[model samples]
Structures are given as structure tokens and as C-alpha cells.
Target: MSCYNHSNPSSFLLMGIPRLEATHFWIAFPFCAMYIVALLGNFTLLFVIMTEPKLHHHTSLDLLIYYFLCMLAGIDLVLTTSTMPKILRIFWFHSHEIVFKCCVVQMFFIRSLSAMESGVLLAMAFDLYVSICKPLRYTTILTNAIIAKIGLAVFMWGIGLMTPLTCTVSRLLFCGPRVISHSYCEHMAVVKLACGDITLNYVYGIMAANFVVGSDSIFIAISYILILRAVLSLSSRDEGLKSFSTCGSHVCVILVFYTPVLFSSYMQHWGQNIPTRIHILLADLYLLVPPMLNPIIYSMKTKQIRGQVLRPFYQKTEVRINFY
Candidate 1:
């Protein structure tokens, strides 16, 4: 049962989707397609934001919104890339072996990026709150320097919080049965395989989740509540609806991102009878669904992004007609 070797501590195997060997290849098709969509969609959104001069010419408040949107797109890219490749390989090629160091790296990026995304969403909520509640002071409140500081703070908060958890997991001695039950390397999944005491690991994991995800969710809720009140107080009903419409895309993205995550976390803790396959499926959706849908949601709901995305095609048609 001695799995650890002092000479090579980085060896481990990933056991992906147990008891589905016959359907692995068939299952991989959809997963691969989703991964491709996530990558292309996020990258396309990033490109549009970075390239569109109109998007950058906005006031400080608008710029902050664009910045957070760009940050969210980047986070979605990293988050999905961290886990999907490994998961796809497991299903498509039966390559379940992942080194311990690699596993640690994947877990770090996935968890850190996720926390950062949550932070970014919270920041977006605040941005919307300012825009809707105090439009006049929006530029004054969120200056360029302040926006930069907020971005830095979000990055630091995620990295700082996840570092201890990663280090703690790395220090544990994993013994025997190096096979991870899930498709990717997750903190809890990896730690559960270790032979050493994991009380601190579990405690720190819970605390990190509460501090990062929990706090972000709470603040987002508060921001929306105040936003709702502000909208309600507006003189015109149409104006109120118009103001609330601005957050529709963000609300959709948040639900897509958090619902599966919260459910998976709950099931892990309380639903002991749930099948491992169900857990794995939820984990995959938690990572994959948001990235795939965020760009589509924003493009459809946000007029500016939609126009920018379509402007090039329209211009091409105009050029053809003028030439003809």
C-alpha cells in the first residue's frame, strides 16, 4: 500500500468516470465540443473588448464594466482550460495518469481562477449598483486608479486565499490507491486520497469556500437588493425596467456559474447516497457550463457587445454592395 516514493513524489493516476468504459469515446464528443465552444467564445469576447475602440471610449464607470467583463472572460478561459483538457483526455484517449505536481498545479489554477471570477462578479455587481443608484458620481467614485486597485485587490485576494490551501494539500503524504475518482484534480478529491491527517485541510477548504465564495455571494446579493430598491424608487415604471434589464446578463451568468457549484458542494457534504458519476458530472458542468454560456448571454443581452460583434459582418456587406 506504500504509494509514495521519495525519489519520485509527483506520480499519480486519474480515474475518470468509472464503469463507463464502453461509452467513454461517445461521451467525449459532447465534452470536447463544449470545451471548444468555451475556448472560442471566451477568446472571441476578449478580442472584441480589446479591439473595439468604442468599448474603451466610455466613461470611467463604463470602462470599469468593460474591464470586469474582460476579466470575467479571461477567468472563464483559464478555469475551463485548467480542467477540461485533462478530462477530455481521460475520456477520449484513456490517459488518466497525472503526476502529483501537475495535479497540484491544476488544482491551484482552477480554484484560484474560480475565486477570482467570483470576486470579479462581485465587483461587477458593485459597478452596476453605482451606475444605477448614483449615476452622477459613477465616474467620480470609480476612477481609473481605483479600478486598477480593485483589479489588483481581486487578484491578490484569490491568490492569497488559495495559497495556504494548496500548500497544505501539497504537504500531505499520499499513500496507496493513487487513483483520483474524479476526472480532474480538485482540492478535496486530491486531499481525500492522502494517507495523512486531513482535518486542517478540510477545515481550511471550508473556510476558504466561505470566505471567498460565500462573501462574494452575500455582497452581490446586497448590491442587487439596493439596486432593486433604487430601481423601484424611480418615477417611471419603464425606466425601472430598463435599469434592471442592464443586469440581466450578469444575473444569468451568475446563476449559470454558481448553481451547479452550490449544489455539488451541498451534495458532497450531505448527499452520501449520490453516485460518484453524478458528482463527476456536476463537477464538469460547474466548470464547463459558465464559460460556454457567458459570452452568448452577454452578446444577446448587451446591446453594445452585440453590435460590436456584428459590426464587422455588416461592414463587409456594405463594402460588397458599394463595389458592385
Candidate 2:
């Protein structure tokens, strides 16, 4: 796909954390902190899951956790890489111009990552339902082989679904006033600058959101309904409690991930009065905060994971201190 041949602007300004005076140290501080935290948190989760024998237990629930963690790592990279470089440019030179190619790449990668997140969440909901509703067949349904197959399918679907939409966007002509209204080259922000007709792109964008966001959310809701029905049928209180607790964390995470997506999608499609600042803030939180929060939330409630993963790190640090 080729960017529309239009006169390039001198530079683009990022309106980040509004009203704060842009100072080198002040601006770089938050970006650096968020990037490091996202990296360390997702890395720890992935490392523990890969290395710990306890986490290697062959269970339907464990497979779901591992799937979500892998998705979260991808998200962490996508979120930080998409915008942090721009933040650094602002700190160093007060502003920067994104080459046409760089802008298209940013837009594609960001949307693709967010769309892929919805896929992962839907897969997780299916995993939960199978574990609860069909316990007898879960071993057969969610084996290592099946989990690997599902993961590959979800990623492939993410790629197939996003490629064309982003390609369409790349063809649009971007003219003067390249100053993006927000920190990143969001799909809509870049497309809006196009001097040419974006009607087809808009149509495809809505369709993508409907299939990726709407369909995933509906499936998740249905999966939970089935899970709830199965839990209610259980006569034992202990069994019901365990099921509820296990699903509660996942439900919370799903809400965090999807609510903002639907909010932005709705405003774009239906024409809402939501302010740009509010929309941008929510979008950033949706992309950035979730990656940091998921690993923390999972580690807190999952006792086996906590003990097997976090405890070993602490024990190792203590051993080093004693030797010193």
C-alpha cells in the first residue's frame, strides 16, 4: 500500500497530558517509567509461566492464563512502541515530523494489536466456558495440542481481519496540517487528514470494529451466561464458589479491555458529543494501562502462580543478600 502523494507538513505536534509545560526531563520521565513498568511486568509473567513447573500443569485454566499473558506481552510492546518515540522527539527537539511510511506503520500496528486483544479475550471466555460447562471433556477439548491450534487461529484471524482495512487507510492522501490532535497516529486521526474521499475506508473501519469488537463481546457474554448456568446447577457451595472466583478475575479484565473499545467505536459510528480530549485519554488508558494491570491482577488472585513464581524471585534475592 502507498501513502497518498500530498505535500508533507514540516512537523506534527502531540497534545499529551494537556496543560503540562513541555520540559525535557518532565516529559521523558513518565514515558520512561510507563515503558519500563510495562516491559518488566509482562516479561516477569511470561518468564514465570514458561519456566515454572507448577505453571506447566496441564489444565484448561492454565492454558487460558498462558494465552492471555502472551497476548498481553504483545500489547505491551505495541502500546509503548507506537507513541514513546514521538514523546522522545518532543523532549529532544520540541516536535518531530513522522515520515509517511512511519505514520502508516504506526496506525496499522496499533489497530492490529488492539483488534488482536479482543480475539484473545474471546478465546479466554471460550476456555472458561468449556472448563465450567463441560468438565468431563475439558482434558480432550483444551489439551496442549488444542490450545496451540486455537492460539495460531486467533493470531491468523487478527492478521486477516486487519490487513485490508489498514491497507485501505494507507491509500488515503494526507495533506497540510499534519499536527495530530493526539499523541499517536490513531487510525481515525491519520485518516481524517486525508484530502481524498475516505468513505470506503470509513465503511471498512466500521465493519472491522463490528466483527472484531462487537462479535467478540457478544461471544464473551454468551460464554459467561453458559458458565453461570452451569455454576448454578452445581449443588455444592464449594464448587460454585471456586467457579465464580476463577471467572471473576477474567470478567473484570474483559470489562477493562472492551468497555473503552466499544465506547470509542460507538462515538465514531453513531456520532456522539464526547470531547476529543476525553476520547484520547480513554484510548491511551485502554492501550497502556491494561498491559500493566493484567499481570498484577492475575498474580494477586492466583495463589499457585504467586507462590511458584513470585516467591522464587524473593528467595533468590534473599540468598544474594546473605552471601553479601
Q: How close is candidate 2 to the true structure, as a TM-score?
A: 0.86
Which residue pairs clash within candidate 2? none
List model 2 lDDT by residue over 1-324, tens digit each: 354444544345565544443455475666667667777777887787778776666665675677667776766677667877776566556664676667767777777777777888888898889888997888887887887887787778877887887777766666766667666677777777778898988888888888888889999999999999999999999999999998887887887777777886676556557777667656665666677677777777777767765687899999999999
Clashing residue pairs in candidate 1 (N, C-alpha, C atoms within 3 angstroms): 10-100
Per-prediction count of colliding residue pairs?
Answer: 1, 0
Q: What lDDT would each prediction earn against the true structure?
A: 0.85, 0.74
C-alpha RMSD by candidate, in order: 3.0, 3.3
